[model samples]
Target: MPPPSPPPPSLSPDLHRVLSLLPRLASPRHLLQAHAYLLPRGGHRHARVASALLLASLRLPLRDHAAALVRRVHPSVSLRAAARLRGRGGGGLAAQLHSLLVRAGHAADPHASASLVQAYCSCGSVASARRVFDETAASADVVSWNVMIDGYVKSGDLARAREMFDVMPGRNVVSWTMVIGAYAQMKQPEEAIEVFRRMQVEGIEPDGVALLSVLSACGDLGVVDLGEWVHRFVLRRGLCQEIPLMNAIIDMYVKCGSVKKALEVFEGMEQKSIVTWTTMIAGFALHGLGSEAVELFRRMEKENVSPNDITFLAVLSVCSHVGLTDLGRWYFKTMVSQYKIKPRVEHYGCMIDLLGRAGCLMEARGLVQDMPFKANAAIWGALLAAARTHGDTELGEQALLHLIELEPHNSGNYILLSNIYAEQERWDAVRELRISMRDRGLRNVPGASSIDVDGMVHEFTSRDGSHPSLHKIREVLCAINSNIKSVGHIALLPESLHDVEEG
Candidate 1:
């Protein structure tokens, strides 16, 4: 027989178009077929084709395939390809791409280098990001500088962030925003406000992002007048139409303890996101308007806004505080079955607290036992408290044992167990527990108290007299005690009380 004719070496136009469109295709199966057709034919050498294939692979639910495809692409093309995936909320893949790029030597491109810095920062590797910044060539641009500054800011290295800010040859809104945001995240509201003032003095116009950061700081510090000032600033700057800025304004008002202003901002917004709804719901719940919070949740659903985990947490907190057990149960069930959200540990903790607080100890225990995951300390603590409150000595002991096993080094567990025994008048058990604690070198943690006055928080431990107003505080306490004694309230010893009365 004659030799078989060789197949065509080039892809047909239709096939080439299909291959080019593979990246845009959402279906993994179709993309996989395209990859199979192209990879063996040396298509991996074509930068555009390889990048498209890498992107498609990255989008797949499988990580191994994504890594293999990335490995096949050239380093520079790979870095460029990875930059396109930013802000898509893909976890860890961006960092993996950057690592591969760095290993393959694409760290020369200033833009790519900056992206690597950002990827490392986003992945919680601030040290690695700093190393990359230090080693990269001096051809760094504005984006590179911003990335490094933001990385330091995001990683809570405010001092280094400030150093970078001071040395930056060119200042932009982003730079100012990063510094202000760093101060805000550090809870240094006064410093954040000072940064905003400095930005203004430097003739830098505040953008929506900068305004949001400053507003957040003002809210955190309870600077209601400053919050209102920023609100007017937004309106004057014609930024009220911006959805994110408006949402931030609402959040600021709520956090500043001005619910009326928060509602006004909410009503004035032309558009609202899920965050807006969640923030308002949380604010309502915090202000003790549980029914209003639920009603707002219902309104959010009516507006076709999807409830995220934060929304559920807000509504659950409202249910917990308001003693709406049935509503809470319904919402919890709806969240899992209808919304398809697997309850996280925080959600489970809230539910346990709710049930326990309502004297449904058995139900709470059953819920804990039936949890999909192992119970955490908060869950166990709630259970133990419920047991003590309901006088279930057996359950209390069991919970205490589990807590001790989970956290052997925690002195609080021993103290809690000892208190439980003492509450039940089991003196011998308490004595034995105390002796065991002594053997283990555990001691009770000192009691502490905090008071906020004029936006300044002062903390004191037992018998602390370090405050400048210590004498005034002592005098007030003495006056209160004298008045209480005058009303015939007498202190009684536990033994005397027990002898005089019985439960």
Candidate 2:
């Protein structure tokens, strides 16, 4: 249940007696009687009495009375009440308050204006919020602008948010943090890092939120040095006590390809949230340390920490990677039977993938049919990949059919099927498939990879010699390839079939 409203800001004993009576009133008729008594006593002019009356009217399901009463209440009280109402999904009531504010000649109150803007934003009426913001631009403060930027971000209009941020007269830590977090969430890590750098250059010491977003960007870019620096900063600032920051630190290490460091951080933590445990398990999954992941999960269970859906996902992924078929099956069943967690698409996808990788093609197909939901493209793609690996052309064709329907524009599905045909020396089938692809105007998308060097991200696309450091990069790759070959390294043939170099 919602918490009781904070006692309508400290009223006189007389006003308090009226406020007390407002909550006890049983119906709109009684509330209207109380309102009738208050107006003639000149109590309607007091902010507390006006607020109490408006709230009492609302509680009685008297929207018309509340809207009319809003016009008589103090502007600040109405806006404050509207902000609170926004949390309860009262967008319409908030709009009524806004209209009353304009009509009551209180639009010039800066604090009330900011609160109204925040209310509109929270209500998902961003366009309405923008209109209010424009009306008060001359009087708008940093808080007002920040609320609008936050509104645009919530509406998934990051471009507009960034545009507003660029033109802001001044920015605080919250402003910079919002943009940084937004960019990281949008998967634009480079932009996030760039803005972070700008924030630092301007002498803005980042708060915990800013640091968390920067660490996320650092992890995405695989910039371990920057992530480590953030970790040190967290330690220096005594922010490591915050579980969320610590969780982000571990995640950063995992994504930066530093599983050892991730484990070190995880082990050192005296307190761990479910997120902390899950992040460590996922870290082991990423590094293919399946045994370690299982051990850690057991430890978590022994400590009486309940595994969440994400925790199960992490463990199942570890099982998939290392071909622990029986273990995977047990975990999948236990997740549903014991934990009472309904399996989502990702869970089903992981199980199907685990089964496929273990050469249980028919059983995997059976699971797809038995699933509560229709098989998605990822499920079909996993089955097709496994079929190609095991030379089950019929199963591959079945997966291809569903994949084509689910994702008609995806050239990768067509290419996988063609590869399966080619592997079996069915040249006639391959030729027909190629003709179909050509007719459909489908071409294989280039594979891409990226690496971070000295804090800068460098991306490379298959067969693309566009980088300025192409010659040096080629020389380094050739040397590494030669060294690996000297140690008897052998490439996986089926995996190489789709490589641009092989084509």
Candidate 3:
């Protein structure tokens, strides 16, 4: 290739310094300073200066201004040259070039129109992009339609994206994937799966990207059968077990409550990324196989797979779930010493949870006090929960003090403190706390419980009468309560006594 052109002759030495940072601008702020310096000198007319600014601010909110600069400087710029620019990456560049072509009276040019649509979408101006698409509707190419759909998908305008998809005369693989991916991204996994089915009915086979998205939807919905079927299809299609596809498969199994299956995949993998190991470790932890998780970490070390912060988080969580206090502490030490992973707030919280559950309330409190980072509500909550378990009223009260200040509006904090008082038969104290809560218009967050009957889930909240069948529900519950009492079971439940005497 020919040597790149030199910086514009009209640019000064200081301005040239800023131009040199093109494609590597420090921040939006610096980009603005450069524009401020150049736009006044009319240097924006120079091809190099506009291209540089367009490149620097591609990810910034300066596209429109850059496009205007290009148009104002060269109203009759070359259409073919600008179209070629669109072939390169970046919506910002495409946008500026679109303006250049439009100024040259080529606004209706198919390539020009499509480039404008893509550029507006890239800059997050989805509405503006849609306007361009609509204006050229009769001549809009599939590329323009697909870009518009993808834009809406990325912008969280799922309804609009679906509308575009439904109206497309001809749908390509990209079109199908974008819409399906949008549903999954919006957490509407059920809708995503339905879209996948529709795509299959239309005889449009899914590529790797589409398949990965479908698997993600299955995982989110906890449909193991669908995930397994997809896995079999993947193998039959000879799809390479790339790192991302492998991770998604493992995640699907883990999320579907089949950690053993996830482990089987993990063990059989010839190549594993950090994400793969982390997924397996987290799966083991989730399934209460703490020892296996810890052992996996050891194996990871032997295999020279460096543990990132997430790995340590999973390992410590494994220890916490299984009450392996000494093991958790050892991993925390190993994290800092051997792995050089600095402890984040979550790591500290895990440690506190371990110490608190192990009846080391004092040590947990001391760690909270000595940690470099200020303890958050979760850390203090762990301490308080531990205190309640071990009947350390003093420490419990101490932790409660911090938790109350940290989460003043959280009704659980007040309710928990009241329970602590009730445990000691401090009825008067409990009543006082209830009164204070009532004064503050505070009510305990209702506990959620659910049951499945005839393959349909019914949910209810404690002390709530919102359900349509609540009256019937209460009757059934009371009968169950009577039966439990008949079985010699004594439930030590707290009484709900709130005096609503607001000050």
Candidate 4:
């Protein structure tokens, strides 16, 4: 049987009556009223009365009343009572209360000390938090260890968090989740998956939060097979009701280049939040399915799911990819007037790009000029690229000059400018630009392309011979070259990306 509840705290008769009246007192207002009546009546010195005040005062955010209330309690009572201050956490109050505990000589009350650790962690003072942790390390409870580890993770010092995690004598689900999440936050998805595998090895069953982080890692790596396994695990264990988990599932499929699978998951969901619709719409936008993404947005509106700023961004991006200039223009207008959404720089960039691609370069230039805020590099860069594409050297030169001032060190801007001049047979200008490039110590960074085939990603760089199959690759290339030559195809080799020195 459970031990009998501790008999009612001992108290004098008048104080007992005051305590009885306090149960009718609930909030900070009632607390203050009760304290005034009792403290002036000599009940301030009574331990039981102070205990009553402490319980009620816990609701108040200010420390003056609560601190005064706890003062009259016994030290042991104060240790336990001050811990309630944790509800008012994430400020100096907890620290002040911690100081009070230290001043009261109950700094070693393990339970109270553990709660204090939480206060310091919440307030972003991990060092003070760790000091309390070290003092209680001899018999540190699991809660304290978890708090310290989480504190380190929150501070973005994952190395120290991992070190703390490794030294824990035992582990709980929270401990494992913190470590996995730290790796994910740092974008070290590989290490995240490794620790998750280790968490499984240690017999800690995973929770939904743990699974979400792992799925996120899989998405970043484009590991569809791993993501599918997680999906299976979630269904088998019945975690599907959670909308965030389902949202992550949809995101993973999209990132893995399987938009059809993402749709299936979307159609199967029983409950969809704004995130669900936005995520699905974004998946379509990324895959260049512009019409489908727009249709989904319409459906979302019909279903009464309000779109936020992110939703507009996704829709605008879709319009850019599919050359739906009219649709993009309409959406841009609707976003401001109908939705009351302020157009961000990204939205303006998308509009300018759409207009530029549709042979409305002047309109694109006008939009950039009319934008409320100063156009950024992306806006000008969009205009510059369109100018180059259309052979408008005059406009291209103007944009390029602006770009160089903004991104003085970007080699692409210089290279593109040189290319524009060379295409116009402006040989002298091209040579001068090349000289300037060399003087500035700028070179185009090598570009590498990768393709994912049969669950493996292979990256290739121009003139790179580091692949394990390099020899075989060259043999195949030689065979293709011979076939092309037999068919009378000709190839041209340029001397340099800019000016060529005659050999």
The collision pairs in model 4 are none
Worst 10 residues of 3 by lDDT: 494-503
Q: Model 1 over residues 1-503: C-alpha lDDT tens digits?
A: 11322333455575578666876787778877887777577565565666667667666644466666555554555655655554425436565666556554566667678777776677667676777787773787778889888878877789998988898878888889889988987889778988898998899988877888898887777676767888998899888788888887888878777898898888777788898899899999888799889999999998888898888998988898888999999999999898888889889888998898788988998999988889988888888877776777787788888888887767776677777788889999999988988898888776764543654656666544566876676666566667767789863333322322331
Q: 491 in model 3: Cα distance from truth in Å?
A: 13
Which of candidates 1 and 4 reaches a greater TM-score? 4
lDDT of 1: 0.76
TM-score of 4: 0.72
Q: CA lDDT of each candidate?
A: 0.76, 0.85, 0.76, 0.78
Worst 10-residue lDDT window for candidate 1 reads 494-503
Q: Tell me each candidate's TM-score.
A: 0.66, 0.84, 0.71, 0.72
User: Alpha-carbon error at 286 in model 4, in Å?
Assistant: 0.8
Q: Candidate 1's error at 73, in angstroms?
A: 12
In each prediction, how many residue pairs overlap at the backbone (N, C-alpha, C within less than 3 A)?
0, 0, 0, 0
Off by over 4 Å in 3: 1-19, 22-50, 53-101, 391-418, 426-503
* Candidate number with greatest lDDT: 2
| Residue 93 Cα positional deviation in candidate 4, in Å, after optimal superposition | 6.5
Question: Worst lDDT window (10 residues) for model 2?
Answer: 494-503
- Judging by TM-score, tell me the better candidate of 2 and 3: 2
Off by over 4 Å in 4: 1-70, 73-97, 374-381, 391-503
Q: How big is the positional error of residue 216 in model 1, measured in Å on the Cα after superposition?
A: 4.5
